[model samples]
Target: MEYIYASLLLHAAKKDINEDALKNVLSAAGIEVDEVRLKAVAAALKEVNIDEVLKSAATAPVAVAAVPA
Candidate 1:
């Protein structure tokens, strides 16, 4: 979603991820901003360590199914 991308952009840029920041990103991208969703995303990531999460996700094993003959 655009919201998540915007948040990631903010995080990657070392900028604070809050409602105002999210609003600016969304507006600049010409995407309509939703107040409730913005608040929700900010709150959800408030205490999250994105780098750790990404690391763990990257190291996690992937399940691959065998191809049928």
Candidate 2:
């Protein structure tokens, strides 16, 4: 869980976010995780509001770009 949080932080700190980045982050942390599940988690996580996860480090704030209509 902590590893997930850290990964999110690294992602949020970055200009771009993706599955590869998330996997790299977790792998670097010594966590062996499923790539598919990780991607699913990352996708689900992206939908999470950052403000709700500020109290703890388990969640991360993702930078969302405004899409042109």
Candidate 3:
């Protein structure tokens, strides 16, 4: 979702991930801002550690398929 992307962009840029910031990013990107969703995302990320989340995601294992000879 664009909302999540906006949050990630802010995190990547070391900006504050708040409703206002999310609105600015969305508006700048020509996407319509949804206040309800923005607030929800901001609240959800309030206690999240983006760095740790990304690190864990990077280290998560993936299933590989075996090729038949």
Best by lDDT: 3
lDDT of 3: 0.93
lDDT of 1 by residue, 1-69 (tens): 898899999999999999999999999999989899999999998888988988898888966778899
Q: How do the residues 23-62 of candidate 3 rate in per-residue lDDT, one tens digit apiece?
A: 9999999998878999999999989998999999888885
TM-score of each: 0.83, 0.56, 0.86
Residue pairs with backbone overlap in model 2: none
Off by over 4 Å in 2: 55-69
- Over the full model, what C-alpha lDDT does candidate 2 score relative to the true structure? 0.67
Rank by lDDT (best first): 3, 1, 2
Tens digit of per-residue lDDT, candidate 2, span 1-69: 754685557656963345777777777879887878777776776787654665455444645769889
Give the winner by TM-score. Answer: 3
lDDT of every model, 2 decimals: 0.92, 0.67, 0.93
